[model samples]
Target chain A: MAKQFDQRKETEYSSRDLETGCVITDPGNAARYKTGDWRSQRPTWNTLRCIKCGLCSLYCPEGCIAPNAEGYYEADLYYCKGCGICSRECWTQAITMIEEEE
Target chain B: MMTGKRIGMESSLGIAEAVKLANADVVAAYPITPQTHIVERLAELVANGELDAAYIPVESEHSAMSACLGSAATGARTFTATAGQGLELMHEVLYVASSMRLPIVMAVANRALSSPLNVWGDHSDVMAVRDTGWIQMFAENGQQVFDLTLCAFRIAEDPEVLFPVMVHLDGFHLSHVVEPFYLMEQDVVDKFLPRFRFPLALDPDKPLTAGAFFPPGVYGEARRAQDDALRSVRPVISRTWREFEEISGRSYKPVETYRADDARVLLLTMGSFSETAMLAIDQLRERGQQVGLVRIRLWRPFPFTEFRQAVGNAETLVVLDRAISYGGPTGPVCAEVKAALYSEPKRPRIVSYVGGLGGRDILVSEFVEMIEKGTALAESGVEEELLTIGVRV
Candidate 1:
């Protein structure tokens, strides 16, 4: 039906892997333990705007988000289905699911 | 040999007979062109209480597939049927049924795609969802359709297989065609298809979550489990087929080759078109053409080994695809078959074709035309005809 195509989101926020600085392979539900793929559509945070509340990590039902070596929150989006619970639950404008086109 | 009697009936009725005999717990489906009769009779049986099962009336094919998944997950045996746009609409959930490891069965009345809008028999409906992770089978006659529908449940519910099955039949041609068949008494079918059991199930006392979200760390295991399940089911499928033969006096295999034992050319097809090709093969043989036909009865978990053995030795391979791939050189089946053979050192000379678009006719005469076109191309060594056959108007 036209309704299915009508709900399409053209823009997706692209996230870069902090370790490799490469794009994530699977922004949502990517394979485990693989080379970084620019194809991943993950969300990157501006840590300065983050308050260390850990809301994003807690809200991620997929548990893809965890603390980095620096104790800063990070998301492992390979298993993320882009449910958008993370961005919606964020108190600060720090967490956002950006579209690629945007 | 166990003696049995056959009675003539429409193929859809035969399927309904088999479904009743299978003693499935749930039959849920949305009606679509060419496949309505199957679910209609099924609903009637449930209404009359002649059969003890829940016949779910669904709004759309999507919901129908979802209901089957729901019933199947609860450890209830479930089945559904659809065609053309209905199959396409259920495309998203088709993979879900397989991935969730529910052994649901579906009868797909093969039909055409839209734009011009025609409702007849073709492979376009099933072809679109070929990679949906379900086990797929194609049946030629009303008899095979009945035989394979039973075989579908056995294969799908086998602890090893734990995969959904799609028993595909040509819309109208087979779905509505009348033929002779022997209906299995409920007792025999009960012995043949046992109640489904799943090691993993949602129980109120020992609750378990399904379709849980997994991160990258855990996703691999689920997929690996699925792949391994498919591989492990090979032996189970064979055993089930043997058991079915013993119980119902019928047998089945992954790939069925006709008159190919002594031949140079092979005609490969899936669905009712194979029947047309069978007729053509007979005519071709009479005319001194060493032509044989290979029908891919089982498409998914494709009989790669059987396919190799059947077409591997042919001097010329002409694969007739009843659906178009748009930009591809071959239909979905031919492309996969070619990929499977590319690794072999002594592959047969192969030519691809795209025919019978929009459920247009793939007549026996057209198959004769396709073979002639293929032989000429083989002589000149061309890649393919790209697309041909079927009616222009």
Candidate 2:
């Protein structure tokens, strides 16, 4: 029941249909909410300097960074809030924050 | 009516006993005047092993309420007490408790707010957090204080209604008064208030986010949900009172009336002054005046339907407020009463009065005089924005 409710957008739910106290009954449902829309700057990673160390993934504030198929660390833009934490924490400066285009 | 022992005890101590009887799991509170005695007694109960509960001595009222929120989230039967400035300090956290739908019961010994630093009884503190979304109720005397405090837990923890409850008794006036009242047995109380089991309690096995932030897209809906939930709690409150009446032989209502059947003039009051107003009504009736009294018991949901019915037939209503709205309508309660009756076809002519402020006494004779003045004002059609009683100036 909770998972089904989580699948619907917040705006789609009416006051009567919402859970009591607006409590999110489903745990770890934050993954469903794409907080990346709030980001003005997106992270870009250089594969050469990445070294597959996964430091950027560990430092990502939103925990949206992960190792891609090639073992290079990449930020999942769908959930990243453009905090630039990964860029700042990258030991080799492999990640850089760039302004998003309209 | 199961006859329990009738004993005289201070109102504050009675409230503490009520909490103990309810078997509260957590009591997190800071000491403040008028409210201190209740918490002090609870602390003593915890110390003496009379009540098996945690007594957290917090640094400030803010921490006290915050601690209650945490404990309540974990499905604990939480209780606390505060007055005046302490209540003001817990202002912000008060909303969180209600919005989260935690069934925490608080006894507020209503006192005057400082500036003049008067540690006296008044409704100033109660009026300050009027819109904080708690289930607010007023207790007229020591027995009512004890009864209502017990009822608060049952009403608040009802699965249908999970709002926090505030049992407000006038500071010093009601809190310090020693009165004889029947104390319910622990076995009876245990049967009345079932073990609280919050459906959305914080548990490691079944995780859920409580009080999550709602952005602009959902904030209005969230507020609407809360408002509807609170407004719909009237039935639960009435039902709880009825169930309590069965065992306790005491009856309570949202709006209680005294000889209001054919009353042409009505005097409305709240808190401890209601009893005094009742005496004044008896005097007015003896003087051949068709007067009655109406005291508001449930304050939060406002009891619009019952209130309208009670005052609809009266020719005039004299509302005495313990707190001033300052520059606005003069009386916070008066403004609400007027608004509630604005659309009624047979509404009474309301004469607003702000009195009994900052611990000032309003004797029975004084209430009679005030009522007479109000009736005269209503009859004369004089547009006085505010009238104050017992003010020397």
Candidate 3:
């Protein structure tokens, strides 16, 4: 076959570095990993300290925590990355729950 | 009848002058602090058209390296300069430049890394990029830099060793030091190192693909090919360095072994620290200590065979690494040397000395202190953990 109008193949899988380029060398697989919303069984906590100190809600980078009944803290485990920063940050140490198997 | 004055310049600057002398086709760079002088002067040469090269102004160090890759692939003899963070930023392209087999030459001013952030003399930067497959050279002084800078192009462009080369100098020490050297005449340089023409390049007529994607099925094979190419570079490095000596009247070797012929304790070092270590060795010699220092010039290939042969008679091998592996006992070189020496039945007892890291000053006396610490371990006949050379606060 005669080659015509050759162009630089735009490889856009975007780990952006060659060392681990294989982590996303396959574009289709890379897209899946990117948009394939992860599932996690992280612990949800009832902040029984109940002092209503909004620290837990504010400190969660994931924003998984919110004010529940009586202004205690509650975590929505569905989207939590399970980084566990929330449990460690609870000043009163009122929230504790075990993780579930994946 | 005279022209430009004969002067020995810093290795990085020597490379810049040689690149200018070679009339490189492209000089792309991001302004990495320590490695700035090479690119800076090269930029001046380009501005004046003494060197007919495209001076690519890149935004980041990674882009700087990528520009060289692109330029070299397009059949231009491309060049670049970088240091610690810059080297880290360009880290991704280091292997690509090798696998694609572009004969790009770079000047790396070996500098300390950051956290506290320092811009001083050390091997931290180049050591961090140890296995990136580019032919790396350590200049002992300004003269080596001027000579090796020219030799680098000859070696990298040699069809047999068509790999990139990084001429390394310590940040402030060799990169900034001035010495006297017989500068190669431009016509002589042109005669010795001809224009680079890559056999496999991104030419329209050839329509070859480079840095292409490959599946897991063949990824390991491709890497193996790279390893094979690099492993075979030792001989090429020797031959080219000899050729360089023949033409330029300057000499070099893979590893420069000093006072090691009959020595019992051998100290291994890279970059500017080796000079200081030599002073320490002199002191130790006067004091009746059986010590010598081995300066590793060709780093990437690591010169395993030559290194093993060089330090053969030594009873104790003290490796002084400027950068720490964080968790590993020795600096990066010691670990690899251990792995290289693992199969050998008889080799020197290895002890690691970590010092001059993070821009800390490594004095000649400190080298003496390290030898004392190391020989102590050898006397006890125990393989000690990492030895910190100048760690006292």
Candidate 4:
């Protein structure tokens, strides 16, 4: 790990202060690390059955579900981990868990 | 001239007063033997409306330290106290507290770790957390405890060195013992330690994360950065000590030496046992034994320069450690001394002894005996790495 990104030399310490560790210089960088690749099972929201109650969004473990322009809820695959939690938690049975094909 | 109020008080109360005077914003703690008095007093102060702060009676030491991390992240001046098992329970969080650069002040009433459930004085607890990257210090008495606790905040909160600081006092030996000491007035303490201003607070307006997870790509650099910060805190510690001396008329040094000039033999100690070792040195000097004493006041950042100078040209250096390192070189302090003086041009032969475990009393006479034994061994040139003294066979 040190062989990479350790551009600073030891001599630099004499004139410079240490880079404070893991301090969030940029806000909300968690969005950059895409966890969608980890999905084996993904949740598909049935927009007609969603009822626009937002229960699927509320129950999403990864918080990847959001409302579409038509006031219906949909799953954002970018941040979803395919937890199936929203599918199980949907009282209206508006979400369905589907296996992702290799 | 003694500044402010001069009164007799226990070491625990003295530290509590120092924290109160520093005006800590949040105190989260769980009661443990030897360390209870400090937090209890703080709790009382909070309950009585004397100190306007949040007093959290956490479920456990882990929760206590976790709460401190949360409170400190919000730019609050956080304080906590723990000992022995309590410290062990909170062990994991110790790393988080320092790595996050939360400037929290922790008072550790040093105690023996329990298998036998011993709650007395020893260095086992503090030694365990040595690698946590916190600025560590040891106090010999009530006055030192009071003064150092205040200095801890200033040193930890310094913008150049935003690290946690742990002030360790021997459990029961210092904490329970009452002694006369000078207490600085609230105004004086205020002047000495300014209100801690943390640049990165968990504010709603300026949203930022404190302890973000590091990937393997940058983990090593992150650690190097933390270590660099730790190693560079000496100047800040010195400046804080100097400022404190000016305010309180009390002098403090990283490694304090006593009557060691022109001595053939030197004895090294830390925490309260250093006082007993001093008495032993005085007696040895009266008999012309040519012996001296060295007490380590600042534990972490190891004070290598001061320690080497303190040991000087002594032919024999005897280190008395309160905690054993089990099967290692001898004791924790002895191993550190040998490592620190390894490449010195004229280093003294170190004789390591582990005694005073589980609150066992290490009398002045015992210190004298250890020095004599070490001197004899040094003359013989026999390599005895570590020895346990005064233990029942």
Candidate 5:
């Protein structure tokens, strides 16, 4: 049986209060943890030359790219590591890699 | 107390029988000398319809322990057997099994490390893994090995104490020796050991991440939690032993003493040699020498309280170690014993001796002689740091 993760900050929990074996009881909890802060580069899509072949979404290492409401694909900056794989593999040169802004 | 029919069997086979009784779910092991017979017999049981368990014959000891880790993480009762070099091969994975809190029971046929290429019984392997974080227990005889192996499953699988356990028996000494011991009935064993249920097991429907990456921020806290969990398992070990005793007539203790009530001097030993020391103690007692014997059954978490109480009153304690520390102050076990008694207000004068290495025999006369020499050394206040017994000069 899976146990529920206690709703407390990791630093706030003492040794005794932590889960046994440091097991993260909440399944799929990684979605809640943001990794976009680790990005050194950002991916920008070019709408003019865009062919919504969805290859960018398919090749995302983090699987963080998806289609926007206008039927064009975009990278979800919240979870993306911005490895530039989408820009490197774009079929129609529709994506560009740019340095992440401060 | 319900006891099954008494039968003569090799200690390794008895261990296999104990695993069968415990109904272990998976046994992943590679054959290593002195420890081969255990897995061989287990493989045979699985080959037939007797065990009904998955016997994974791994490529090496490293994979053996790694496979056990996967099996145990899935909430399966797992077991494995290894020896000197084999134990060292799986050294790194031992930490993972304890840190992840998987209740894997391992049988170690204690053997001396290789260099001289000896496949004999010694505590060199056991001493090497002393800090690996698994609860360790040494068995003095075939009966104790069988009993402790059975108890290991119950102790490790306890939800409150979800750490691995190592049941150590001397290679070729206890593992190869054939002895008759009362085997508990299957129904009695079933009643004694509850079905294991790991609360946070890996399930596809309920996916919880185990052994997640702990950065520097939380790594210290995780280690502290593991340390506290290990130190707190002594009570569960005792309670499991007690519950096992209630069903079967066999009783066990952390630190067992023999004829030590009012003895002035005591001899301490572990593993199979403790039995021989007992005979030496009896001989000394018959000759009007007030001597006794103390055997340390529990090694990890170091049974500090029980050990202190067992050796507190003795004026001199002769500690017999089977492995050398190689240029250190004394044998590994002796150093620990001295450290354990250091803070006590009234502690015994400890004389350390390292012998019986690489499967060499330490005779009863030698034990008697060592005790007398230790007593003499303590009485004379001559501080000889380390003494090697039974060596031809």
Candidate 6:
């Protein structure tokens, strides 16, 4: 479960009148600002190859890959910065990288 | 609440005992004399299993403070001690600690700065870092050393004020001198200081970035916030002190007065010298001289209101400083005191006198002479702003 921001009566996180340091209210808010737009190459999973060894999930730098209802791991596009680490880490050729369109 | 055994002990050891009793989670320090005794005893405590804290003996003062920053960011109760050049070396990290609002407590064995390689006691080191945004306080005796060390944790960790605090003791004078002081029981310390709980911690379940870089657009706001936070901690400091007083029955104030009720001349001092100056004030009073003592215990967030009240009805205020401001002013304390009272409608003429540099003792007799000279200077309306006392002519 994601942790919630601990707000108290004493603390007033004013955007206009700041009296405290930088604080992020939403947990995992980094995902909100999608980094997929920064990608030059995108990973395309070849599910037909039929190998769920989970190496792609293990080696993913952004932790964007997770198992779907079918029990096969897929990339979370919102944060997948398209780093192709999963494609490179896959022991079986179950994933491939393709050029991201501008 | 004061249940611990009373023992005559070296002041530095008393400080170490307080840190141990506070149950500090991390202690990172590099050895520097006057300050060495504190970390040395702390190391012994950790090694002997007396303290359950991680003791990091880093290679340099810079890395020591850097380690403390990391430890504090991890939501641990962190501490470190350094002196003179060591403090100067860690000067940059000091700002990072305060700006990040890491509640790390540091004990600075106040010592004279080096050019002549002197290692004696002076306020030059502490004065050098006066504006680094850390909450600063001076301990006048062994008892204050123990109590204030413990109090620094409470003041720094309070949710209302999470800024780091530095508790200073005069080097060799307070650090090495053996004095009898009361030690509160561990249970009492626990009652006074609750378990450390940082609002922002580096927990895996609740990950959030800390000490992030601020762009030019938002940088000014961040700095202004830090300033506001420092100013806001004043009441928290008083509240923390008052609570501790209830537990220990030992009172403290930022601007403490001694015999200044009905006086024409007052001598201002700080740290351990205030006690010595009290005796001098007694001597002056015996000879029918109306004199008193005003000691500044809190350095930063400089207590302006209490200081003005302490110097009430006095015609001349003799400001004694152990550190010089080089070419700027006679003494930093004198310069600050003058600035604090500059706006008041009724204020005494400030006589700037610099003495007791590099651990040289300021005799009791010299205190009387300083009062006379200062009163004379104030009366004659001389514009001389600086005087170096005890320097060979």
Best candidate per lDDT, number? Answer: 2
Candidate 6 chain B: 10-residue stretch with minimal lDDT: B212-221
Worst 10 residues of 3 chain B by lDDT: B1-10
lDDT of 1 at B305: 90
In order, the Cα lDDT scores of the candidates are 0.78, 0.92, 0.76, 0.87, 0.91, 0.86
DockQ, structure candidate 5? 0.62
Per-residue error (Å), model 5, residue A79 = 4.1
TM-score to true structure, per model: 0.79, 0.96, 0.77, 0.88, 0.90, 0.82
The TM-score obtained by model 1 is 0.79
Model 1 residue pairs with clashes: A11-A99, A12-A98, A12-A99, A12-A100, A13-A98, A13-A99, A27-A41, A29-A78, A30-A78
**Clash pairs for candidate 2:** none
Q: Given candidate 1, what's the lDDT at residue B193?
A: 78
True contacts kept of each: 0.00, 0.83, 0.00, 0.50, 0.81, 0.23
Q: Tens digits of per-residue lDDT for model 1 on B100-168?
A: 888888998888989678888788888799888888889889988988898888888777678899999
Q: List the residue pairs that clash in candidate 6.
A: none
| Poorly placed runs, candidate 5 (over 4 Å) | A1-8, A37-59, A65-102, B380-385
- At residue B221, what lDDT does model 1 achieve? 47
Interface Cα RMSD per model, in Å? 13.9, 0.8, 10.8, 5.4, 1.2, 5.9
Model 4 gets an lDDT of 0.87
- Output the number of the DockQ-best candidate: 2
Q: In angstroms, how far off is B38's CA in candidate 1?
A: 0.5
**DockQ of all candidates, in order?**
0.04, 0.77, 0.02, 0.30, 0.62, 0.14
* Top-scoring candidate (TM-score): 2
Error of 3 at B377 (Å): 1.7
| Residue B362 local lDDT, model 4 | 90
**Superposing all C-alpha atoms, what RMSD in Å does each candidate have to the true structure?**
9.8, 1.8, 12.0, 4.5, 2.9, 6.5
Query: Candidate 3: which pairs clash?
Result: B7-B181, B8-B179, B8-B180, B8-B181
